[model samples]
Target: MTRRTSTSIGFVAVLLWALLALFTVGTAPVPPFLLNALTFALGGALGVSWVTATGGWHKLHAVPLRVYLFGTIGLFGYHALYFSALRLAPPAEASLIAYLWPLLIVLFSGLLPGERLGPLHILGACIAFSGAALIVAPGPDGFTGGIGLILAGLCALTWSGYSVLSRRLGAIPTESVAVFCLATAVLSLPAHLIFETTYWPAAPAGWLAIVGLGLGPVGLAFYVWDIGMKNGDIQLLGASSYAAPLFSTLILIVAGLADPRPSLLLAAALIAGGAGLAALGSARAQRRLIK
Candidate 1:
């Protein structure tokens, strides 16, 4: 496949990542541990079943063991921290702060071999981040939500590592990477069983939400992202992925879970404008390099 095509596909796939991320993380702290555990487990089962029926089950086992382990740990860390952040801060704050990931990617991109940023990447990063701060900092409080913002910062930074690692996965099947992540959950389950002191749910309604989460966000979403990344450009992946957060923010407002903050609208504009311009600018730069 051409570099351009891969980049475009990855951009679309990863952009949806924000919406699922907000769901998993925003709901994390408030939902009982049982809720997420069940949700993820059900999703995992459903995902595996779908894959198996399609004879794509081997995709799960196709990745290198180390890649799987890192992904698992990295993903787990994001979930745990993100949920905890929700408990500590507002969803907007948490979501906006987490959006700082592009910046994280920019910084970390330098450390990874063959992933160095061009000057345009820096300009795009600035535009993207300015938009993030606007969304997150809505209201005169100037970054209210205090410690929660800090926690979200940490969460974004952690996921940044995962994103960086993903770009480095040359020729590795996305499915293999996913299988490794699922295996990580299994590997970590024993530890969770041993140390997690949360109460168990005895009802089916609560159980449904739990399962929905894992399958929709963690399982299906990750799989989609993996496939996109394997065949796409890193810059495209980064540029277009903000759609997830934008979608989530809109959902929260529609659900009445979040009051529509005027600042949020402003943030949305910045994020959308910034990300769009950045993507376009990157395309232009790539063209210049070609010329």
Candidate 2:
């Protein structure tokens, strides 16, 4: 594929990632551990089944055990820290802080062999983060300082670290994501059994939420993101990623899951502008490199 086409596809795929917020709907009715476990379990099963039926199941065995180990630790750690923080802090606050991974990814990309750390990337990250902060800024009773904040920071770290490593390991079969998800399910099952009550989604809405989470955000998004980050323009993807939270908030408001807040408009401007600036800067740099 042409570089331009690939970049456009990656950009669109990452934007669609905003659908990930659908995972939030499931969280209201399901315990975090159970929600995570079930989502991964069901989704992973489908992935495995598809690969097997298509004669690609050997691809799973071909993946290095180390990737499985790292994927488990990284993804599970992200889930544990991020969800636990939600219980301790306001969900908005926790989410805002945790979503810092995009900026972190931009910064971390510099460490990868071919990725360059440009000033525009840094500036755009700051602007995007400012917007994120504005949107999740606390109401009168929302901000409680403690472990939640620390956990949120760690969540960002683990994810940023994971993304970089995933890119470096991009040679691994994409089917490895199924194994990664299954590992998460197996690891999370004990926590679900011990600390949480296991109950399936009962109402139609609840069931819908769970199934949606399993199929979309928690499942397929991972596959798309893996390839996008590995081959697409990393800085552009990082800058554009700010849109995920924005998209989530807008969708929530539209769905009546969240009340509308005035800050969203300003947040939209800052994030969109930052993403645009970063993307433009990257394009100019590529043109210069070609020249």
Please, what are the lDDT tens digits per residue for candidate 1 over residues 35-105? 33454565467656767677875655556668767777776677666666666677765776776665566
Candidate models: Cα lDDT each: 0.62, 0.71
Quickly count the clashes in candidate 1: 9
- Top TM-score hit: 2
Candidate 1 runs further than 4 Å off: 1-5, 8-12, 25-36, 54-63, 110-116, 134-143, 187-208, 289-291
Q: Which ten residues in a row have the lowest lDDT in candidate 2?
A: 17-26
Q: What is the number of backbone collisions in each predicted candidate, taken in the order shown?
A: 9, 0
Quote each prediction's TM-score. Answer: 0.80, 0.86
User: How far off is residue 112 in model 1, in Å?
Assistant: 4.9
Candidate 1 residue 73 C-alpha distance from true site, Å: 0.8
Per-residue lDDT of model 2, residues 124-232, tens digit only:
8778778767745665766454677678778889988898778888678767878888999999989888998766666777777777767776776676676677777
> In model 1, which range of ten residues has the least summed lDDT?
26-35
